[model samples]
Target chain A: EPEVTQTPSHQVTQMGQEVILRCVPISNHLYFYWYRQILGQKVEFLVSFYNNEISEKSEIFDDQFSVERPDGSNFTLKIRSTKLEDSAMYFCASSEAGTGHGYTFGSGTRLTVV
Target chain B: AQSVTQLDSQVPVFEEAPVELRCNYSSSVSVYLFWYVQYPNQGLQLLLKYLSGSTLVESINGFEAEFNKSQTSFHLRKPSVHISDTAEYFCAVGAAGGYNKLIFGAGTRLAVHP
Candidate 1:
């Protein structure tokens, strides 16, 4: 079965540096999403994307966070300036028909900011 | 907003033993329920989901979940589990209406021992 793929399985960056997490969702899927989980915490929704625009975002997705579909296949989450709290496992997911359909998730990128 | 709660942080069961992971949600309106499994250092994988209909949904694997509207619960069950079933499980909820966004639980870590 086809699955989502993410690059840089682990990322380590300085606290003030900028970082981008990349994901290649399933080829035929139309909707994409980003979620984050702090160590031992529940996964939190960051943002949802469709048609190259953000459909919805959570309070955690503040000024520092931005998502872009730079290419037809790549969906990315960029943090302008990373904070210690930004360290978490960032997951990318996609669904074929809509949200009603179950989502397929990538292995996730573990971001560690020091 | 929708939220999910997983009561147990960890569960240890012997091989071939039955297991149940409880989940509850708080939502004023109807919602979709889901169970996801995560292997160590990996991403979330869809195990099962409850959208509508029979109120009982199952995965290709032997796992199943029953959606209880009044109790606002969707508990996952497996008649017997294998050592390979050891993983972290998460329960999630999404509003059933348009713009459905997912909210996840803290997760339950299942340890299958010989």
Candidate 2:
């Protein structure tokens, strides 16, 4: 089974620093997404990307956050200035096209801001 | 807009016992329902989904869910669960359009005791 790969399984950064989380979605998938799960909270959608642009984003995804497909396969989420509240498990997911096919989520990167 | 509700926050069951996790959703438009599992220190894995056709869907690992459009529920069930089934289960909903984004519930932790 093909899998979505994310780098830096765990990351610890100082507050107010810049951090970039990387992900390699399934090769054939066209729709990519970034979600975050705060401890004991529901997984929240951050942004969705397709056709090289952002399709949708939530209110939580403010000016501090941005997503990019820097390469054909690499989809990344960058936080310009991280805050202590930014600590969470960030997940990368991809789907072939529609919601019917469901999605594959990466193991997630645990971002801890000190 | 779509939202998912997982009624139980945690469920404890003995090994080989049957278990059920209740999920409900509210969507103004048609939506796709999905169940994902997350084991300790692992990423979210697709358990099953309901898009169309038969309302009932099953996963290879002995889990099944019935989509009740009238009630807007998609509850997961396992006749006999093992300790390996211990994990956090999430119910999600995605709208049926080009730009589909998933909305996840807070999650239900299933603890299978030996």
Candidate 3:
């Protein structure tokens, strides 16, 4: 089975630094998404991407955060200025179009903002 | 808007014992129901989903969920669980529209003991 792939399984960064988390979704999948889970908290939606543009974003995805499908295969989430509260497990996911097919998720990138 | 509710924060069961994780959702529009699993130090994996045809869905592993439209619940059940089944389970809802942004519930941690 095809699975979404994410890079930098773990990352540690200083507060106010910039960070980029990368993911490679399933090739045929058109819908991409970014979600984050804080320690002992629920997983929260950050943004959703389709056709190379963000279709929807949550309040948590403020001016500090952005997502891009930089290349045909690479989907990335960038934090302009990270805060200590930004520490969480960030996950990337992908799903097909026009169907209720469940999504495939990548092994998350654990981001620790110090 | 949509919201998911996972009643149990944690469930501890002995090996080979049956288990049930309760999930309820509220949505203004028709939505898709999904169950995702996260094992130790890993990302979310789609366990199963309820799209349209059937109210009942099953995963490859010995797990099943029944979608109760009246009650707005999709509770996951496993007749007998193994240690390998120890993980966190999340219930989520996606509106039936273009953007598949998901609303997730606080996860239920399942701990299978020997």
Who wins the TM-score comparison? 2
Q: Which docking class does model 1 fall in?
A: medium
TM-score of chain B of 1: 0.96
lDDT of 3 by residue, A1-114 (tens): 888999999999999999999999999988999999999999999998887788889999999999988889999999999999999999999988732676788999999999
Please list the C-alpha lDDT of all candidates, in the order they appear. Answer: 0.92, 0.96, 0.92
- Candidate 1 local lDDT, A9-68, one digit each (tens): 999999999999999999999889999999989899999999989999999999999999
Q: Which of candidates 1 and 2 is the stronger one according to lDDT?
A: 2
lDDT of 2 by residue, A18-110 (tens): 999999999999999999999999999999999999999999999999999988999999999999999999999999978877889999999
Please state the CAPRI-style docking class of candidate 2. high
Q: Which candidate ranks first by lDDT, i.e. highest? A: 2
The residue ranges of model 1 lying beyond 4 angstroms of the native Cα positions read B97-99
Tens-place lDDT digits, model 3, residues B1-114: 999999999999999999999999999999989999999978888899898888989999989999999999999999999999999999999887565788899999999999
